[model samples]
Target: MAGACVAALLASSACSSSQDASPMSDSSASNASQKLSGTVTVFAAASLKESFTTLGADFEKAHPGTKVTFSFGGSDSLAASITGGAPTDVFAAASPRTMAVVSDAGGVSGTPTTFVRNQLEIATRPGNPDAIGSLEDLTDPKLKVVLCDRTVPCGAAAQKALDGSKLKLTPVSYEQDVKGALTKVVLKEADAAVVYKTDVRAAGDKVGGVEFPESADAVNDYPIALLKDAPNAAAAKAFIDYVQSAAGQKVLTSAGFLKP
Candidate 1:
């Protein structure tokens, strides 16, 4: 009887152990699977504003109590802020070259992933008042042109496109970011601006896009990564993963950003 009781007790113990390990009641497991709730601050390139804003809204809706905040500016400026100790969870840059600054400083959690590719487009006022057709058209000098500052990714791509065409352009202004350059056209302050295809798309009828052949040589690859000091690490990872998901691609591609 004693031996039988000991075996029964052991059997009961085994059952309890197995039950404890099951998915139904493990608190750690529950936490991992539970809906994440927190604010995730993302520092992203100015050109990503529209698409990222849409994705951020979708993410917040899907996660219930979660929220996403963004600081959008030039990719170089954004990277500088992240490495300068400004608090942020994720960094999405207009180019892998910009993201490299953060990765090299150990400011990111893991390897950065390219999420999209963008090509340069000539953004002209509605109805294309300047009647611009190609990269060489901007050389007419009668039209006021704007280009992103040479320090930013958009400017870099523009430079490459201009170099490919072997055309020299002296713009009225070299704006600090793509948005700045795009804004000039949107506001009708400039006749045309060399910006991203996505920028022109987001601007809608406010601006018209001109695809230049030289843009082939200046495609910009955008990369994103979770920051090492993310305040909401779990939420940040989920957001980064979400941006790489099919749903995110739908939003990005719709806005004229190409697949990475």
Candidate 2:
């Protein structure tokens, strides 16, 4: 009887020890699997805010130990950051021209792939009381118009479209970026502004967007690439891959962005 009791106690101890170690072992493995751990700072164009935020969340969930930090602004500004060594891991520009600036400066790791396409839209206050229908209407002296500065991608596209139609518009303000241009229209500060289709979609009820036929002449391609000196190269590559993936494309498309 004594021997049997001792044997039973030993068996119980061994089982408990094994069970306890199993969870710890599993935890160690889990930590090890998350080798790509760090904050990857991404500089993306303003129009990409909504879609990039969603994708960032998905990336964090997929890679347990990774954190993504994004700076959303004009493509020109983003290009300046990467060119000036702003400690950015990735860059997503609204135009290939902007991306080329970085690539020319040797700031990019590899070739950038075009992820999405965007075009200009006429954004006005909800209801569009002015009865503005076409690009030529923006030139009306009574109507207050706003446009992005020539440096920004949306502004460049807007310029191209306006030039194609031979419409001369003297906007009240030349905004620094697409969001800034849209804000003028949303706040009713201006009757209309040329902004990206994605910006119009993200603005919700703040403004109404009118698709102009001339927009086809000014479509801009969004390109993304990893930086050469990325602090977290693995995570940067992974995030870039995610943006080009089918799932990422779906997210952008849902946000009203055109696929590349």
Candidate 3:
């Protein structure tokens, strides 16, 4: 009777241990799945905000298990962040010059592709109160013109256009980014500003855009790339491929970007 009782106790203990081990195995599998389920962070240019946001949502819908997160700002600033280790999986810059900074820093995985192009436009207060119609008009002594600083892509393009046209503009303020320049015009701080065409469209009723012929001389190309040290390389590559697809091009084009 004693031996039988001891045998029963040992069997019970063994069964309990087996049941615990089974859940432990399941937990390990669950952890692995969780590891595969995470967000892919993207740093993109501010001009790309509208299009990229639309694409990000589409990407999430297509890839049910992955999340797409974005941080949009000036291209130069975005490149600086990637070089500084901001934990980004992908980067989309408004200029090749800015993308080169990341390439030089060994932050990008491969050659960045030109995904889209953008041109500068003169944004003014709605209703054309100043009757600003041309790039040469911005040089008017009475107009309070604003421009983006030379450090940003839009600023560089604006400079090229001005140089091409042999026109000099003395702006009331040199804003930090294209949007900032547009804001100056929107707030009536300046009578006009040279900002990206996309920005004017995005601003909707806040401002009006006037196209100039010299803009053709200074079209800026936007580039996109996956980072070399991306924590989620697979997802990053997928996102890149998606951006270069026809559907992605449609989204960008609809938002005023020129297909590359």
lDDT by residue (122-196, candidate 2, tens digit) is 998898899988888899999999999999999999999989998888989999889899988888899999999
Model 2, residue 123: what's the lDDT?
93
**Candidate 2: residue 167 Cα off by (Å):** 1.1
Best by TM-score, which number?
A: 1
Q: lDDT of each model, Cα atoms only?
A: 0.92, 0.91, 0.90
Candidate 2, residue 116: Cα displacement in angstroms equals: 0.6
RMSD of 2: 4.9
Q: Which portions of model 3 miss their true places by more than 4 Å?
A: 1-36
- lDDT of model 3 at position 183: 86
Runs in model 1 with CA error above 4 Å?
Answer: 1-23, 26-28, 31-33
Single out the weakest 10-residue window by summed lDDT for candidate 3: 31-40
User: Cα RMSD to native, each candidate?
Assistant: 3.4, 4.9, 7.9
Q: For residues 113-197, write the lDDT of model 1, one tens digit per residue.
A: 9999999999998898778999999998898999999889999999988888899999999999999999998888999999999
User: Who is ahead in TM-score, 2 or 3?
Assistant: 2
Runs in model 2 lying further than 4 Å from the true structure: 1-34
Top-down TM-score ranking: 1, 2, 3
